[model samples]
Target: MNFFYFAYGSNMLALRLQKRCPSAVFVESATAEGYAVNFSKLGRDASGKGALFEKQKSTALGVVFEIAKSDLKSLDKAEGVWFGYDRRTDFEVVTNSGETIETTTYLPPKMDIQLQPFGWYLALVVAGAIENGLPQDYINKLKSTPYQIDENQNRPSRLDALETLKSTGHSNWQDLFTSPRAS
Candidate 1:
């Protein structure tokens, strides 16, 4: 069975997904209605302590992945769905062709504002929004999204780590850097 996984965030990054599902096939870029991606925090990543907000929302813009049924389990585990996302079948519309296709969308489980997104994660999201054909104004808005660095302090409202990586040619350097450490 082939599964159409509607990707609306970091998964939008082709290089990132290729690293996970080596054989994953890329369907045309798509979008979900009544939804837009936003930068927010998830609960699990917060760990009841210092938490940074990740990019999340019900209406987030992402990409679509068509993968073999055999790879579904591995893909799910890679996405951290076991912790916060609930897998569901939904409709994906190809903005360029006006085609609607059946696909699996991940509905995030409710969590606190602590599940902050790291710089690399946010970069992928920004890339996804652009790929999904979101306007420059919207992209700029996403680029300027604000989040709390900690409980008492909010960081600058702009791309941080991801932007840095892009500048340093490290956006697709997963094998090159195991941890978030700078190259």
Candidate 2:
């Protein structure tokens, strides 16, 4: 049994998502209308993470993956469903081929506009967007999002994510940390 999962944040990265749910398989690029992606979800690391918020006439572009039902618990754990995101199954996204698909996604319980994502975290998202061939304009918007540098240079997750991006052949991944817009 499998279910479609919509990934708009770091989970959009195939390698990243696969680590959590090994059965995850990329399906297609999708768009959720009337919503916008924002880095306003408070993360366990005290940095902002991506969340979708209702916005008039806006759309959030992302990737869809088919995940095994047996791995749902692992996916929930990775998403911090207990304290972070609320798993939503009511969302409907349109694929590039103009087909409407019912999918599940994660949404923050609350939003904090003042928060900003860590540079490395945002890099994961941008790299994922590029890997999935999302719209160029959407990728540019993601790059323009403000981010803060992690004070801990040796953060394990940060190192792992950046390394994953590099290993996935994202040559300019390092440049993503260079000039993040001020939060």
- Candidate number of the best lDDT: 2
lDDT of each: 0.55, 0.89
Report the C-alpha lDDT of model 1 over 56-132, residue by residue, as the tens digit.
45344456778878777777776566666667765555543677788876666554543455544555556655555
Misplaced by over 4 Å in model 2 are 177-183
TM-score of 2: 0.93
Superposed by TM-score, candidate 2 places the C-alpha of residue 182 at a distance from the truth, in angstroms, of 21
Candidate 1: 10-residue stretch with minimal lDDT: 47-56
The total of clashing pairs for model 2 equals 0
Candidate 2, residues 46-141: lDDT per residue as tens digits? Answer: 999999888999999999999999989999998999677999987899999999999999999899999999988999998898889987777878
lDDT of candidate model 2 versus the reference: 0.89
Segments of candidate 1 deviating more than 4 angstroms: 41-44, 47-60, 92-94, 113-115, 131-134, 147-183
Give the per-residue Cα lDDT of candidate 1 at 138: 52
